[model samples]
Target: MEDEHKELYIKEKFNNIDYMMLKSITDCIYEAVCVIDEYGIVIVWNKSAEKLYNIAYEKIIGQNIEDFFDDAMVNNVRKTGVSIENKCHCPLKNHPVLANSMPLYIRNVFRGAVSTDRDFEELSRLYSELENANSKLIFLENQVKKNLGIFGNIIGKSSSIVKKIDMARQIAPTNSSVMITGESGTGKEVFAKGIHELSGRKGLFVPVNCSAIPSELFESEFFGYCSGAFTGANRKGKIGIFELANEGTVFLDEIGDMPLSMQAKLLRVLQEREIIRVGGEKSIKLNLRVISATNKSLQEMVKTNKFREDLYYRLNVVEINLPPLRDRKEDIPLFIDHFIKEFSEKNSKNIIKIHGEVMNILNQYKWPGNIRELMNVIEHIVVTNKNGIIQKNSIPEYILLHMKENEFFKEYPLDLTRAIRELEIENIKKALKITKNNKSKAAKLLNIPRGTLYHKIDEYKIKKL
Candidate 1:
């Protein structure tokens, strides 16, 4: 009797709760919804269901869910009385969606089931966009390829610099060994990287200073080693520069300073294209391009018996001689402009320009240490100043002293006209030096027009460096 009373109470309560109102609410919502009776016939098909399935609500309301949806969860809920919550569904081909279906009860007996669905196309689109954004972030994280320009960060427009880049590009596609001869600070590694970038190789660029590696460990450093190769070795073994740069470039900097014994070992690797680890029995093949660089002359070293003749010739198959900073003085002004801007932004300084006298002094100075020295000087200058222009007083003491000692004003004629001509020649030289032999820039620095400067050059027979 009590069970019968309880069943009657539940039926009354369900009748009182208007399902029509519930259907109206679900139709206004954007998510798709469908409700069915215990016999698996659809009772409530909301407006969202019509949009999702592209079928009218009136048309699907009386239809069995099994007939339209190829057996939806409504029939299973009636038999098992278990909720099938948040299951993936595909009612139609090529249309994936998420669905939640649960058994409805009245008086603790399964009466019906209701389901809500979410579209999958929107979700997939969002996921794809997120992946694309992540890829862009990673590219930016690598410095946009070191902020490289057409010439791979080799900054200069001088004839000498242009010629060097043209030659490097020409040789980049070939597999022949290249040896770059230049001063210690003349950007040999920069050219090496540029060549590798142009080569389209699929591996990293590996650089090492042969002089810095101790003679005792040269073999292990260049040819790698096996596990437990020596008393103190990495337990997992290590890959050498040659192996690390497989299918890429291996830059051997300061190669001229390598010990005689190491030179012989390196030559064997180059000739055979294989290397045996320090203690390993098996030999590893290498498909790598070797680019050697040094300030010293390997030919002269071979003549003096400091370097092996065969090794020298092997590395010099296609030689590139990078002119010294003193010889390519026209590029100095270009370098100065680039480095000053670079260091100013790096140091968070507001320095706009250098004093005219400072520019003139820098023009006259001979940079024995090359671009590396110039970069250091600009970094210091930017860091020391708070704002405004860089004055002559801020120039380093050593540079100023060197400039004073190297002044060339006293070697001119004493006659009035000749002295005037000499002074004019000196000023013209200073302007040309400050502008890096750029006629337009020199004219601007000398406070004259380009036409006037050109006429004067012709009249005075002035030679621009």
Candidate 2:
């Protein structure tokens, strides 16, 4: 009799709760919640459910959920008296969701089932938004490329490069001889090409390597030989580099390597604005621009009598020097981006993002070979990258090892004594921070005496944060 009274009391208290209370509670949830009777008729539907399925409560309350959704989990749960959790389901033909359904039982008898569903379209919407953003970014980048004009191929925007570009543009229209001086792989040839493009010359740009030419053949090569004048010469008499470059630009690379004997002849040709073919008396008039590049200092070579002083002045009438990659760390990222895009398209890769840590490591490196080495490294990374993202591990092993070897003095100068001092000061500050500015604990952490730590702190001028 007491047990019966307890059951009656429990049933009475639950019966007091009504549909309005359940509606209020379920409507507050963000997910779609629906309840169905054991007969498969929809008994309750929250506002979220209505929005998710585009169905109203009045329309669905008495209707069978199976009529609307052939694969409704609630119907299965109601019939089987089992629960389904975290299953992907498609109720409407096109609408998909992740749903959970559980059987409801009272007094040891199955009554109904309830299911809650989270929308899958939300994630799809977010992915669409990201793709749109990427498209816009690519468009803006293309516009920036278009605005760069002929200088677009010459990538760096650092103050050193920008100033040089401006100077090149200003000197391009003039016919004065130009001498380009820089270390090898500093992009001297590309800069020369940019100048030639800006010069608006009608004739083709001719490139001659002074170091590659044989001393014996230099005269015949510069001044085309008459037919039958030299053995193995073209029968019709080949056009020389200068004659081929008439009304255009002549790029003389490694000009310091020109033999001293040929230097005087070249100076005479430049001075007289004419050249006589080998074994031919008639002089051919010339009209062209001279641009010479050399890794060696022509001044030093002139002082040593290796290079003619007159030829040096003729070539060095206007000089432009390119800075190496190590001096312009600010431009490394720009080069990395440009090279990655170039090599990715060439190799049919869709490389989209670079890992932040990879950028940091690349920026910290000192490129001994300048832009050329950096471009090669980026090509290797992109070609070997299996995923769309460029990770730190994708970097070449040599660069990673070099970075690790130099990790200790990354922020300090290469001077050993000064680097040691800077490292010591940095550690002292870290110890202080860890100890909450307590000198005793800080010294103990650093394995030094408290008095010594205090003296070192004062000496290094470290203060509490």
Candidate 3:
């Protein structure tokens, strides 16, 4: 019964119309499909097969498949009557493919074999890219090793940054009161420390957050309180920030948040260059460089009668405004490399390079939180990324959402033909919309043959309006 059924099936398959239908169906398949008779004669060849072997069926059909392809799987199955399933092989030079070949039998005799081949060119290209990326990563790692120690903490080369650094260096040796102003997380504190380091001061560089201190404790915090000044005062009479920073520098962070009452006392202390201990008669002389930082506009505060005019002028003697990260975008790459190295080491990761796509996203982001926010984001990425290279999927969700929709697809594609096809599909859709679904007009607009346009419309599965 099975032999009779097989004979009937073979008779039906050999019909010319049925053979043509089978060939057409094979052409539509994504994978390359081919058929050869038991005598090694090429019987059928689809478009993908022609592309894969670089041979058109018009010339290959009726010819021996063995002449074009050495050790061909289709010929092997036909000769041996054995199946090859999901076997990886290189049918063409340097073109790796996964193939499946099955022998065709009719009435208990081997007639032919059919094979499907999926080219691994894209996969091979991906591996090649990864190798190139690794080479680049090694170069960057060497660069980070050589240059990381030379640039110091401030890692920008922008004109604004260079000017600020130059100005800071020039004013460092002077006893001028400097105010560093910018948006929060703009590294105001870091700039202050940089100034203090350059001043050649011998004593400690003390940083005091004025906004964090209580109003009642302001006087005691700025100038040491006597042993019995307050109930919580130490019997030994502890020293204040000014006294601790004597002969060095005192960085008053968020100085704009200081209360008006404390502002008067601060102004007096700066003017006199001395501080009298609370509940003590003796005055303590101080030699210090006072550097204050704030994210607020003290001039506006002075106009509003909120910040003291005298105190503002005293602090603003040499004001250095730090530009926001967005204003100095050219410096972002430097910051990214610096932070990536710092955090990668801190997290015990050996990250070498960031993905180009990731860099694009980072560069384009507004960085509302500035350098500090960027630092945190890099740390987050480093901690989560297990490999030496950072991939796009490792980026935070919020950042990806913030980017323009079109920027995501800007990466160079591995398949040039596929990319061109996608572009064609987009333009075809646009042209169709413009022409209100008039195929003739759209074809003319695209400067393509009308028949070719119709074929592509069906090939790309484009829906008509």
Candidate 4:
């Protein structure tokens, strides 16, 4: 009776424990749980494991594990006696899974194995996204490096300009003041921009037109002012151009026109490497490279006491003088070809050739306005020459008139007034031909703002060629 009562008590406790509660707990887990017998047959499969494999637990249990996998996977796991985690595709189920298999051992006896699997498609997609992001990041880094280099947009092959660029490249690696002197339109700012791009500074290029700034605002503009420093001061203090250009380049354009008083302040900043605000007492340290440009003769200014001699000497440490366009007339064709292609593509025009005589006329003209003027002329011709070839008559009347008035042309026995009238008549005829008798197209092709071209055609009594 006592033995039976002990057995009954144990049975009563087990009967009170809920089977549904245990099943529910196992189903809620994220990882698959399973057990196998000694023959590699599935013995127990939980609800989580069933949902993961898309197979019912009742059907999988008591089935051989090899029924779901190839014999090779089973043999490998059995031979290693270690857990094997690998990716496998199930064609019948049309899904992919990452399976982990571990052998079960009992008292030094080899039993079967138990395995669990998880979805691999989501993980693979995530990895691909990560790889794409990394590629884009690398591309962006390369672009940033290129943009901060000296050769960003200074495209040319002329030996003189190339040599100047090479020298600028060499000096750009240092923090020195550079003075660029040249004729009015000779691209001094281009050299300054190249220096700024080459310098590994973290700040932007701050250009100040010394001549354009008002005399009254010179102090507060160069050196920042505190709030209420003057009558029109902002509520918050404003940073000066020099302060904003810290750790970069401050381009002083037309520096020859700087006021005498401002020149003293600038010289102090250069010597001391510090600035005191217009109305503040405290001094601030600066780390910037000054690149100044001017078309005026600084030495002449110094002699006349209009500019500070000390400041002139300080800024003249490394000077680059650009050659005038007339000096490098050999580069005219090169610039012409470049501009022609650039504008043709922009306007979707198919101008591919220039008549020999037209090119000769262009080469003979003295480019007083330099590259800027040359570029404008090329843009005009490309937009107006609709015959797909630039003819001599397509040249502007102003240029032709200038050439006629030239003293050199007089020595050649050319009739100045008659030649000007003839060239004007020829240009009008060519414009009409290109327009196919359409007055509007002809006017556009002449580049005289339509109304001007029409008025000229009427005044010249031009007929279709």
Candidate 5:
């Protein structure tokens, strides 16, 4: 047996022609590939193999395969004349790897084996990051249960969210102004607060909703007024948001809504880094980071002469345009899970899992109101569902009406009436299966009128099984 094994290894020794051909083949392959004779001696070691294992080809080519790689694949292939592919190693390194080994036979005689390696380093990094983000999300959910005021966590791993999060993190250390643009309820305030927390700012994060402040009081609200400056003013006078937020950050929400007069004053404060009280003359030098957000487009407003172009450019030193929830549907499951757990704990309930139909509808909905709307819907379901499961009926009537109007199969071949009829049949069967064939329960879960449901059941010939 030993002699036969030695014969097989020695008989396959590379001839001059074989050596050049093997070298050329190995040199062209991008993956790390190594060949071992039946007797377990390395026959061919490519450049990629040298770099992958940090070994010199000179030292490895004539050495025994056991001197380096101890995997079972080569030996198994040599013995069984079989091949293995894409075997993932446990406890992977910085460069996670997938390996393939195949038996090499010459003239129907088992001689040696060749193995290839594929690098998974980039994939490993991405998966590692996603795991970290998910862990942090769970931690945030727990902490949110403890208190609702602390909101620093930006919980998502979608490409869209990750890009914005990376941008926020990168710009946090710098003092440049950031203009966050997105539709309403898209978590603009959350992102602003997150930036402040990451910025190492000692002062508070003061948020001013420009639209909420009355135009007449905009000056006093932004730049404090002296005592007795006007009737009904605070006796000792009060500092404005900018001055109060000195050494920290002033997040001006809805920057586009600031009146033209206030826009000029705000621009000066941004340029001069100072603010004068409404009635006093002395200028208070401000050391603050201004991070502003708006649902409206300042660029278009500038074209219309409603917003100052210079101020727009000033605030937009670094722009972060947050994608709407509909754009990153991949993050919906994460957000839904977070909100459900959060609201469940908040309401002291065990409720979990939205109805399948409702979830499908939600995932399909274009969330015009964004995250805030999603949060509100989850809260309503948690509060209303004492039965522990949120049924389709738990959804607000308006949303249900919209879902009906959209009619999932509107683009199909059938007309609206036929499409709706088929949808009802499919849903009835699904609801029955989900409810374990309980007719009354399934009807209730489907949110259909009981009389109408019975008529459909008879019309469609739906059975419990």
Candidate 6:
């Protein structure tokens, strides 16, 4: 009987040990586990629960479960008395966590609850990363819009100018050579600079004037000469313009005037993607975009043998033709206003008003020099004229000469009987010349309505200058 009792006691002890082992395994696997009794007093707590709540089991074992949770959570668990699972974010804790709880039951009667949670730090990190990525996307979108519109150093509101700007932005990112053809004083360089700014290149913009450079120094200037390359050559080898413009844009202005020899060399560079300096045998690799501009017609020059046909073809991969001031006469008033404000500020003058007769005279004459000449005339008037207004007499002598000789003003008599008519005709011609034959702009400068200017232009039979 004694042996049997001992055996029974040993068997019972073994069963208790097995049960404790199972409990330990469950506690280790659970993330954050806690249990409460019928009175909502804490009964069990695991290692994860202790780490999450920062409270040890030994200290909180018979404590009320409501002590650790918010009032809302305690009320929810008590009222529901059913299993609950949800996600919650706590800014004060700086964490987002998943919470799960189930009601404890004894013989179908609800007792208290068991709860568990997992840290949401990783989820929060992912959300933060997504937000940052979205912000960057928004910034890039805005930048693209600016590049496509007037924000990217292009300031014209006219539809034609806007279309040209859009085209430039689209082409700027490419590696193709672009040929920009426009009359002198039409802001070709401005357009070229805009292209460079949009290209995302980190190199400098090197501008070379084909007409300005002396023919004798063409080889040395374009492809740097080594020491002793010639009598006047520098002692130390100099880098050529092509070399300086590497990894950047090289703007060749007035390309129509480039010498035949230089044209051949430029063609070789374009084809071979390399350049050899004067008096040097070694070739240097080039990675650059070529942008050439000319007021002269390259096709005509090529036919006449003044410009090389092959070189013209190579550089004409992408062509951008800027409209002449006369073609886009609508922009005249805008340009005048812009220039007036600019020059007025520079000279510290308040010459804001341009008399009607003066503007009419400016509109009638032809502008051979285009916008550049117009700007110069405005500056001259602002400097010479006083009383904050520009009158007919203040107009320069050259403009008056052109207007007086104009055929349209010949029919009107210069006598006292037709003095007003003659004076109006003369002033209108002068204004035409000053404003580059832009009627609306000339009218604005003359302070007259566009409709009236049109009537005068027709009545005078303004021989289109």
Candidate structures ordered by lDDT, highest first: 2, 3, 5, 1, 4, 6
Model 2 Cα lDDT, one tens digit per residue, 87-197: 888877878898999997768777688899988768545653464345345644764665423224787779998999899999999899999999887888888878898
Once fitted onto the true fold, the runs of candidate 3 whose alpha carbons sit more than 4 angstroms away are 1-151, 404-465
Segments in model 5 whose C-alpha atoms lie over 4 Å from true places: 1-152, 409-465
Give the TM-score (vs. native) of candidate 1.
Answer: 0.57
Q: Which regions of candidate 1 are displaced past 4 Å?
A: 1-152, 408-465
lDDT of 6 by residue, 1-465 (tens): 244553354345334456346447647865777666556666566788777667886666566666766542433565677677765734125445667777877567776677677666654446535643454456447646643222225546667677778888999998889999888976777788789879987665777789898888887887887768888777665677787677888899999888898788789888998888788887888888899999999999988998888899899999998876666556667666676776788789897688877767666556677667777887888888678888888888898888766653344555775877777777888789888899888898878998999898899888655
TM-score for each of the candidates: 0.57, 0.56, 0.56, 0.54, 0.57, 0.53
Go through the candidates in order and give each one's C-alpha lDDT: 0.78, 0.82, 0.81, 0.75, 0.79, 0.73
Q: Which lDDT tens digits does candidate 5 get at residues 111-189?
A: 7898887666544446635643454456457646755333238877889989999999999999999999999978888
Model 4: per-residue lDDT, tens digit, 211-259? Answer: 9988888888888776578888864556787877777789999999999
Residue 317 lDDT, candidate 1, scale 0-100: 89
Write down the worst ten-residue block by lDDT for model 6: 146-155
Candidate 1, residue 39: lDDT: 72
Candidate 4, residue 163: how far the Cα is off, in Å: 2.8
lDDT by residue (tens digit), candidate 3, 1-465: 244553354345465357667778989998888887677777678999888878887777767788888988888888888899988888677878989999987677777898999887654446535643453456447646654233357768899988998999999889899999999988887888888888889876777889999988888877877668889887656567787777988899999899898899999999999998787777889999899999999989999988999999888899899999988889998888887888777778999777887888888888899987888888899899887888888888888876644343344467999888888887798889889999999999999999999999999999986
lDDT score of residue 439 within candidate 4: 77
The local lDDT score (0 to 100) that residue 344 gets in candidate 6 is 83
